[model samples]
Target: MDSRLALAAVVCAIVLCATPAALAQTVQVWTRGGRAYSLTCYTRFEVVPFYRPPNATSLVVAAASPATPPALQPTESGVSTIAAVLLVMSCIIVVVKSRSRAKFEMIIGKNSNRKENIEELLDNYGSLAPKRYKYSQLKDMTGSFSEKLGEGGYGTVYKGTLPDGNPVAVKFLHDLTSNGEEFVNEVISIRRTSHINVVTLVGFCLGASKRALIYEYMPNGSLDKFIYAENSKITLGWDKLYEIATGIARGLEYLHRGCNTRIIHFDIKPHNILLDHDFVPKIADFGLAKLCNPKESYLSMAGMRGTIGFIAPEVFSRRFGVVSTKSDVYSYGMMLLEMVGGRKNLKSSVENPSEMYFPDWIYRCLADLGSLHTFDMEYETEEIARKMAVIGLWCIQVSPNSRPTMSKVLDMFEKSADELEIPPKHCFYSAIQ
Candidate 1:
């Protein structure tokens, strides 16, 4: 009976704590011992606690009273608002990410076909004749003819990435007015020879009206970028310059003697020389190359086939000498002199008469051996400069017969610089005067 009575009291207190009118009502209460109990009741929402005096032996329930809430409201509305905002942000992020991914996929899809075609060609050819590619495939390789590396009289070159992730340079031939002799010559000349110092023909494209050549991409690009410009992209040290000059000479020698037929590179200049990843020089651009019978000591050509500054005197007039491998030698010599001097061989708009012809100025400096200080060169560099000057003067002799052969040029490279004999100044000086 007593336990039931205590339980009833707790239930009443809970009701009073939850209801305002019930809490306001007061009720007299009795203990189990039949004693009147005085109790203090404290109520919080949905729960109540009672404090009893030491003399009290029973529980009491005060009438429930109306409860007033504190100023701070419930958190449900704020929580709902935050959840809604998060949902919208998440949806927006998903949409944005999807669009970005779709755009990237679309770009990849455009180039993928070209990559696949190039891979197929590489698989089939395996270093035979340069692989033939369709025009669409070339477009993909070159990214719609973008990223032009350079342009020449023949065509423009672009930088491209192969499907297999290898980089390549694509040379697109300009529309020709006459028969495509330049294209045919480049294909034939480069295809016939394979040497370390010679640029490799990676592939070619002859689809529809488009004609293009793909070559192994040279990372450092042409030698002229380093040689001609005062603020060159990459400044080559004297050692590197000498190494490039020697490599060019060796390449020319291989073209002359190593091939089945003697190949004369009618155009040899700094711009035609390309540098690979390690700065190894490779002779490139054989559009003007001529293949001759090994027995033929002289070749007769109808017209000149080289750059103006580097052209051999014989190529301009037969009065100088017969056009032969010696013509290439003469061109190589002019390029070598430019490499040594770090400037062009000829300048049309020069104010100083002595500086009008670079070869003459360099020849005068080398003859006296005292002008080395003017160049601000070190001991080793000074020696290399003198040797290159001596050999260059030898190769550019007015008479084609007076010029040393490519083989003799290589032999000279092997010897110490001190052992080289400076060629006597000839009609070249007189012509310039």
Candidate 2:
């Protein structure tokens, strides 16, 4: 009995030890008839003795569990995860780069199209097309822009010499916001003109980002310098001033009538008039010029144009009249008044508030011819001033129809002061008032 009890204790200990490896290993037991049975050990174990006949033998065999596969280390697992993240990030970067490249190409395409359109127009100009120069050539011709002659709203002018040794004024435009419209206007307008009174456009330069215009250099510079020269050495005698005014009128007449296409100089002012060594006036700065068919009497405008004091009444308000070449006549009239007065038509610094409006003072001066003596002019000079003033007043009449054509203005200039009639006092007031 004691021997049987000890064997049962040994069997229980073996079963408990093999429980962890039960899934991978097999246990075998031999019974009294020599039949082998396989048993898998579990958490709960039971040992049962076989009934042996006479001298029967009992045997138990257990095989070890196969070695379990080695588990993955922490470092190796981290490496695989990192590699997947990098691949995903690379794909995202490539997609973003492709999109950005497409956007940049679109902007470049638009600018190229605009340039092509302008070039195509120039090609159609045939023999009328002005000379074209490279941007680099401009720098060479202007001596690297060494001498700046003047500056204005559109650009700066530098004195340059052409290959033929003829002097030229090179204007380098700085305002790009106009989308090249001003540059195109100056070129096209001058190309159509071939009058001594009109400034000659020698050449032009248009590139991706640079634009410039080359013109015949006027030694005497702009008319504003001489007209506004207060107590300065630059002074034009009354006779010379009359000649300059008449030359400007002829130039305007050419623009309005002589050209195949009627051209209106929207911004006609003293500053835009250039003078040669002989002080002969030449109309310039066609940035605000408009081209229309000669048969069409009126022009359509998108917005008001010209300097404030010189803009015609009809240009700012349709109630005054339809916009037409008459608008240019009005500006010319204002410029004439400024020329005779030696000051702006509207003066804020006048001692007498009544004289603040120059046209009114000059109009009153015409009624009493002796009042003109205040200008310290001789009889002949007063005659010239009165003729110019009467003509100017007639041109500035509030109604467009009331203003004479450029042709009529030239006629008035040729007439004697006594022969001319002063415009009605009611017609001289500006619409803005």
Candidate 3:
């Protein structure tokens, strides 16, 4: 025991005296019959500094190797899962934003193209262009289409007012087809005429789907109102009726010969004739008017036009005659006869079924001039009525060639009532009979 204590004392002194580098190095100090001791025994009093055995350095290194911490395994897996989820979310956000941007750009491009096309159209119209109004202006003028005046096949007519405080009529055409033929026809036909008898086109709108036409307001509206309204408050005298008749004749004559081109109005009727505040007749609704060179006397049509009762026989069947301005004369004649009798020409409810047709009965009365009183004869207006009947007979001749020109019709109006003779019964009269 004493020997061991002395040895430990010496070893302790050596350990305290040795440099740090020396202590860290492995040393071989074997004593005969000595037991092995570990370097970790430095903290215990029972252990003395001991020499390393063979291969002891490797053993120490192997034993000191650290074990992996269990806490880190779950943390690593959680971090990996969170990273994958973030990557997927980022991808989704990018795809959604890209799609939205593409759609927005496409819409903007379409709007730009449409605006450019409308601007180009307006520019092409140039000096000859009628007043062009914006969609907003039309809405303001029409008060959001509040007061409707009438509606027809083409569109609805609304009452409007201008900045100058002038009341106007606005016709808003329907967008029935991609080809706007009716709108074009109405604008072109009326644009060429500056006559007082024609309805004046004040302005027009061509904004998007809202195509509209502006015209001077006719306070008295269409002539059909007075002629067809049995309960009309204002009863027109014979003089006034005759004046309206002559005005319509002059309007037709103007269309036939007055302009540089012969404008044949395919549809002519009381509904199409508008009257101003002073009762001056103005021809309206020129959607079917054809503009032809003066030398062209006939027009070939692909289809029939004009109202059923007013359309000339030739218009429906080629066997009657070639279509011409005379077709309008036939329509005018029918309208004139209706105005004279204050009833429809083809009425089926006549007291005498034998005289159901107006023209047939009128012809029989004219054949015997003494029977004029049978026509509810007012002595003062009998001659005026007879004169109109003679003119009507001349206009409705079966052959288009037999029909007089509109100018001749005007001259016939000035002739004395007795001098006007009834037109002879032709194929047209026979067909009706």
List the global CA lDDT of all models. 0.70, 0.74, 0.71
The digit string of per-residue lDDT tens for model 2 on 197-248 reads 9998888887778878889999999988888789422378888999999999
Local accuracy of candidate 3 as per-residue lDDT tens digits, 306-327: 6657778888688999999999
> Per-residue lDDT of 1-433 in model 1, one digit per residue for the tens?
3443454456444443533333223211211111122122221111123345789767675644446353344333333333333333443444455556668888799657655654564455456657677889888988998899997655789998888999999987764442334344446556667889998888777654777788999999899878887743137777778888899999999888897668887878888899999999998876433321111112234555666677788787778889999999998999888887777877767788887688888888877764466677788878887788889989999898899999999999888777987788775722421
List the candidates' TM-scores in order. 0.64, 0.68, 0.66
For lDDT, candidate 1 versus 2, the one ahead is 2
Itemize residue pairs with steric clashes in candidate 2. Answer: none
Q: Which ten residues in a row have the lowest lDDT in candidate 2?
A: 36-45
Candidate 3 TM-score versus the reference: 0.66
User: How accurate locally is residue 42 in candidate 2, as Cα lDDT from 0 to 100?
Assistant: 15
User: Residue 325 of model 3: what lDDT?
Assistant: 90
Name model 1 segments beyond 4 Å from true: 1-127, 175-189, 231-234, 287-302, 348-351, 429-433
Per-candidate alpha-carbon RMSD to the true structure: 25.2, 20.8, 24.5
